[model samples]
Target: MPRGKYTNHKGRNRRFTNPEELEEQRRKDEQERRWRQQRGDESSESEEEEDEADKKKASGSKTRGDDDSGSGSEDSSESENSDEEKAKGVSNLIKIENPNRVQKKVKKLSTLNEDLVSQKPQLSRREREEIEKQRAQAHYQKLHAEGKTEQARADLARLAIIKQQREEAAKKRDLEKKQKEEALKAKTAQTQKALGKKT
Candidate 1:
């Protein structure tokens, strides 16, 4: 099936068969726009303040009560109400007139031109590599300072071996000292025994 002009979802078409139907549709759209404008509903504006509207109603009633108490006619109060409606319509318009104004965004978009040639000297790849190397070295140094690095573990193992060797040397010195003391005592006893026999 051939695709329709209006909607090509499944070769479907939507259109008015009569010119009068189109006119009627246009009229309905215009009426909707006029109604929204009078109702103070706008695309750019948020919902009108309920408290402000209540205040206006309260003030209007107060004026009406005063007019009722006085001899003022009802026409004056109707005009005042119309003026308030006009003020509301004027407030619904966008106040800022800038065309370059930024709209709110969830994701950021870059503004830099990628194709533009530059005269200024750009940083070489080696510069960036050096920066990365320096960062890694600094990070490792911090870990070493905290004694949480692999180097710290290796040093601890080396220190344990040195301590064991020192302890063994100290035990050997103690044994040698004991043997020298025993030999000196034996020699002194032998000399004493010989002198006593001679006496």
Candidate 2:
């Protein structure tokens, strides 16, 4: 009634022309907007609640208050200090007054020396054979006294061979023993370095 052409489309023109329809559409749009806004607010509030819970968990874990009385960090360090002090105390106790320990240490040291000596190389195979030959010769002499000349002659021959072998074997064993002594000397030197020659 007022002007030339309604620039809007036919449906839009119809809506604009009817006041009740326009009001109803506006009310629907406002309701949807409010629903969306409410959902956003609820999501943000939930996130804030989660953040607060996480902060509480982090603080609680750092303090370890549930497992220990509120001073967990302090107590652990104190315990470590106490353990070190106890170790020092034990060392001092051992150093200050323990004759029995000293005696035991000396006994152990002597035993170690004996072990080192015993580990030195022993008589050689030839030497052992020579000793066996000597025993056999003695047996053969006894047999000769009992009237066994053939066996005694054989034993005497073996005895001469054994004597020759014994000299060679003795020399070999002496050389091995000397080498063992040298090895022990080197080992002792290393041990002294490690122990710093404590009296």
Candidate 3:
């Protein structure tokens, strides 16, 4: 006699007799309510426009399907032509060019120098310097803790040798550059003298 309960001929209650079914129904109802709420947030005008667009698309697809069914070979050719036209239209609408080729020419001494400058390391210069200083200080402290005073002096001597070697390499490079410039100047002068003699 309950409002939603029905007594079968065997006198069994049939209203939500299965708990799993009741839970499933509740879940479905909840999902539907959420979907409706989401749909309700959009403006009515936008919703109507979307509905009209969908209806038009549905009708168009249905007409295309009917045409394909009515005339098989002709419809297939038309569809292919339409696809090609669509592709052409899209390609015309979106023009793509290579960014590097389009940009201004970059003057660099060498690609190696460009790569070195452009490549970003994980740590910044200041952070790397700080880390190196901390490591060196830790190493010096460890040496002093071990009472190896001579080892610290040897480390300093090694660093001085490294510095001297770097300075010598720089000077050698400068000398080579100067030599190349002088050789170029002499070659030009010889060419000028030969031209004068010929004239």
lDDT: which candidate is best? 3
What shift in Å separates residue 141 of candidate 2 from its native position after superposition? 9.6
Tens digits of per-residue lDDT for model 2 on 104-153? Answer: 34458788889989896788999999999999989877889775798667
Q: For residues 44-163, write the lDDT of model 1, one tens digit per residue.
A: 122222432354454332222222221145447745654564434334221334569988755433323432333455679999899899999999999988889999889888999999
TM-score of each: 0.32, 0.22, 0.25
Q: How many clashes in each candidate? A: 0, 0, 0
Rank by lDDT (best first): 3, 2, 1
Candidate 3 residue 189 Cα shift, in angstroms, is: 1.4
Check candidate 1 and list the clashing pairs: none
Off by over 4 Å in 3: 1-148, 197-199
RMSD of each: 16.4, 38.5, 30.8
Clashes of 3: 0
TM-score of 1: 0.32
Give the per-residue lDDT of model 3 (tens digit) for 55-168.
435433222222232135656875775455444334632335554676667766798688788998789889999999999999989987675888777877898999999999
lDDT of candidate 1 at residue 53, scale 0 to 100: 39
Which residue pairs in model 3 clash with each other? none
lDDT head-to-head 2 vs 3, winner: 3
